[model samples]
Target: MNKSFPAIFALALFLSVLLFNYAAAQSTVQERIKQVENNLTENLQTNDAGPMNLQKRMEHYKVNGLSIAVIKDYKIDWVKAYGVADAASKIPVTDQTLFQAASISKSLNAVGVMKLFKSKHLDLFADINTYLSSWKFPYDSLSKGKKINTANLLSHTAGLSVHGFGGYEPGTPLPSVIQILNGTKPANSGAVRSVFEPGIRQQYSGGGTTITQLMVTDISKERYEKYMSDQVLKPMGMLNSTFAQSPAGLKRGLLATGYDVGGKEVKGKYHIYPEQAPAGLWTNPADLARYIIETQLAYEGRSAKVLDQETTKLRLTPYMNAEAALGVFIEDYNGLKYFGHGGANEGFRSGYYGSLAGGNGLVIMVNSDNGEIIQELINSIATVYDFKGLNKTEKIKLANVSEKDLDSYLGDYQLTPKLVLTITREGKQVYAQATGQSRIEAFAETSSKFFFKVIHANMEFVKDDQGKVTKMIFNQGGRIEAKKL
Candidate 1:
């Protein structure tokens, strides 16, 4: 027997084992992807909580399109696209299709501001007026004479108003940043003034973020979109991403058209956001995965594509708000930390999260006003990946209420002069439809109390001494009495 025969046999065996392992690993990956697709759960889960198919889930939520990218072991494990870019045009989502980043742009905006601090010596703590040659924040007595800084703007602690923007409809003139800050004509939004003194607490001001948009333009002498494209997005390997309000150079057919909660197409397809820093960005989940991976690597001091280790740490550290860091929000889950942000524009809702350890992350984007699907998808992903403390589904049990009781709660309750909440009973199901919105089913929590799964609100039917329903106490952010008519 030749001695070389034994060696050759050993080598062949090793190669066979390697090939088998690779094939098995790939099979597992496919299984996980299938599980994620087939297991989309509802936030308000019922006792009949069977795992839902992704397409069914999309139909249930009236979402037009969705894009997803999951990161595992510091790399994108998988990327999947679902549904159509536009329901009318029937364009499918390939994920080169761009969706508005919305407020998620603030996350990268923080990176841009920190880059200025690192490279250009812009003081993060100095008065924002120092760098505002184009326009200054009109800090009246509302500011209490305290100065607002770059950090405050990034962390949303500037105490500014204008929670968010409603983008301009088609053919409408876009507002200049100055006009926007002043709430002048064509801006549509109110003046971004101090609602309270600066540095009071965490007030989410896209207005403040817009001010930093100005600061970036003023300091860099470049358009916000161009500067972001050159300095931050490109550097992070997010080649497909842009801060352009109307993203140019994108393929003619790649922009996903917007849709409303009722599945109606946006009149102009999608509104134009001149508020670029706070709301304007057009990118997909794949590009977002690159951004998340780079951030995770930078946090671990293994990479410095856009931010160094020290600056990255500073960016992740909570500023004025415990959960809100510079551009991202940091939440601790049983000692496991994560940083992420969610975004919404006129017809789009998106969210992304990257774990501080283990390099696990997920990005989800949809071209519909309904955000109910996003959280449900996240719950499924969290369960599949065993991401500690990431699932936030609320399983609710329906209370015993007679069909007659539900029907008694039916009536038009005048919430305001022009607004009425019309509660209608269809068969045995109780549905609440606003004046111009779609009907949402309210599950019975008790005899007189009802809760909505789509919207986070509850209503209690107030009965008179005669056991006649007279009013409804609607509690959503605040309690209000709506007299039944």
Candidate 2:
């Protein structure tokens, strides 16, 4: 009886051991499945795209291709490219394929100036007049005594009239740097003009940066492109990058053809820009990422390789009550703050935003007039990383108002004496149009504050003594004022 009982106990214990092993294996398999699901989910569906299939999602958004570089853990974790480099070329965009960076060139240009600044060759607050020789600003009575400094120019507070330099068509006669600055023939305007006194308001002026190029040229005694190359690009090892204004852009076959909004390829000959400091840079995303990485390192008080710690910190901080610091815009979205720049020229629009903390950076560039598509996707990427609120939301006035109340507010609100915004109603929606401009859809925040999402700005309506809305204010591009027109 004792021997039989012992055998039964051993058999029962063996069966119990097998059941425990089986349960443990099942648990491990379940964990593996969960990890896989998480990875898949992270790759799919952003806030704007909703839950459609990936292929359909890409096509619907008109994104021919996209390249994303993730900068985290103090280094680039990964970089990926999707879609064709040229839709008709049947050539896929690889990690090495180049994309025209457009206005993002300004950020790189800023780095160049800061390099000089770090060496004590350039002063931020010194009068720009000391650096000029060939061409000069018209300098109306308003700006005669006011000194335009390098810091003011870097911050876009130079009070220049032209917001940006116009790129010439490929076949058109290229303007010299002096010609472009003078706004002469073969150029868009005769000369750069001053709309307001320097340092009075924060207005974006790419022409102002041209003055920086001129200053660099005078100080370095080299062509603008040569100076940038020797001081900035070469030191950074930006092998493929070039100042688009350089003759080398033509020889190296580095220039990308500008496109129209409808995807029609432009046939004009390549036009040269003398004003290389504003939007003349031509480089790829990979090289640009290197620039961004250095900035991040500089912020951490680590070795930046180029700019010193003091100058880099000054460039990152807000200058003159503007959202932009130095060449990039300083903004806080969700809980994370970042520094980067956005560029738009001809058919291209690109933006690169990176977090100051250890999250990845996002760079988006498209050769189409579809700024909306890029902006929306950029916002989506931010949201995916849980960046819920950005400076992107439009502010419109009106609170708890019904559809019936929207009619009274459907009139024009003047932004400035020169700029008038007309508000018209189409069904339940309201559209605002500036004089001599196409009407754009305006999103509302409350009842009094409305903002344009197509660009950066907001509109607020002020009421009169009788509770009647008397005036409305539209704020955009660093210019703010009321319009009673």
Candidate 3:
């Protein structure tokens, strides 16, 4: 054989090996994705409805678009997107599609604000009014003379009014920070004022988070978005995120349209959140995964990209015997600690859970008002990844019951002084609604027992000696009680 022939044969062999390895790696990733899509479960065994196909569940829940990022060993393993970002345009959601982060904004806002504390520019325990130069907090006797501190505000222990915000429609006039705080005409929410003494209890308040937003703007003397982007977002390598009140210029095209529970598009496609610090974040799950990874690394003292180890520890620590931490919530799931935050703004719902150790985490974003799908997806990822303390689901099977039998369970059962469980029926389907909440369908597990698909709660209709339904027993969170009206 000629010398040229030998050289050509060797080069061909090298190319074949490289191609084979690349194909094998792609196949492995696809297999893992397929596995994750099929197995979704919840913490409670009774809540599991068996192995589920994620695409089918998306159809079942009418979720238009979803994005998820999985973190392994302190880095993002993969990111997946599904459904249409804009149903009208049929634009598919991609790795770059942006969804409203909603209350998840608070988590990052806390980081930016904490940086101030770390730099000794602000005191975590100092009275918030001390740094607030523009507007003063309207304190009253309800405060019990307990001044609201930066830590209390960040932890939602400031006892402020307004649990959350109902973002303004795209065309509606957005309120200024001061206008929102005073609950002025342009503001759709109530005034942000003290409801009770600060640090007394852990009650959620988006209004309190807004106060911190103002504090950042006032103290930094820079726009909230600019300060956050420079100090936190850019530092953490989250280039795809923004706190813009409206989707303008090039960012508008990247935004996923919001959808309601009925599968209808939101009136303006998506709401505009002027409360930037609390609900204005527009980002994708891939970008959020970066935040989670940074948090995990900082907590472990391996990295301080955005926050140092000591500050990260303070951010994750629970306050006032409550699971609520600074902007995020700390939970011990089966012994593994998780720091996370959930966001809901009109037709958008997002959540992220990052392990305090082990560098494991997940971030999910959906452009739908119905959030039941988010948890299911999280369960699937946790199961497929074998995330410690995450898998706790058992299979559940529904029982068939007659429509007439279901009608018998229709009635109002009072649970507490202000809460009532109302059961209703339509054809063969049964539904349950609590006071001040939307109605949810309840699937029959037995003639007298029913379970909710959206939540991990169950109901049992109790009968009297005469075989007539007299009360309804609600079982949830280890509490079982009979309610009769």
Model 2 CA RMSD to the hidden true structure, in angstroms: 10.0
In Å, residue 63's CA in model 1 sits off its true spot by 1.7
- What order do you get sorting by TM-score, best first? 1, 3, 2
Instruction: Give the TM-score of each candidate.
Output: 0.94, 0.71, 0.88
Model 3, 1-485: lDDT tens digits are 69799899999999999999999988987888899888765444443346778898889989999998999889888899999999998999999999999999999999999999999889999899999999999889999888999989888899889999999887788889999999997999999998888888888999999999999998999999899999999999999899977756754458999999888999988888889999999999999999999988898899998789999999999877648999899889667899999999888999999998889999999999988878877778887887766554556666778766677788899888889988888887888998999998887888789888678799998888887888887888876575667
Tens-place lDDT per residue, model 1, 1-485, is: 69799999999999999999999988988999999998878777865777788888899878889999999999999988999997777889996888888888999888999999989659999999999997777778978889999999988898999999999987889989999999999889999999988887999999999999999999999888899999999998888888886777767769999898889999899999989989888889999999899999999999998999899999999997579899999999878999999998999999999998899999999999988888888988998999888888777778878877787888899888999999988776889998998788988888898888778899999999988899999999999999999
Candidate that beats the other on TM-score, 2 or 3, i.e. the better one: 3
The model with the greatest lDDT is 1
Q: Write down the lDDT of every candidate, Cα atoms only.
A: 0.90, 0.67, 0.88
Across residues 247-336, which tens digit of lDDT does each residue of candidate 2 receive?
443432234444555555545423345668888876666777777777777777786678766778898877887487888888875556
Q: Report how far off residue 295 is in candidate 1 (Å).
A: 1.2
What TM-score should be assigned to candidate 1? 0.94
Query: Against the true structure, whose TM-score is highest?
Result: 1
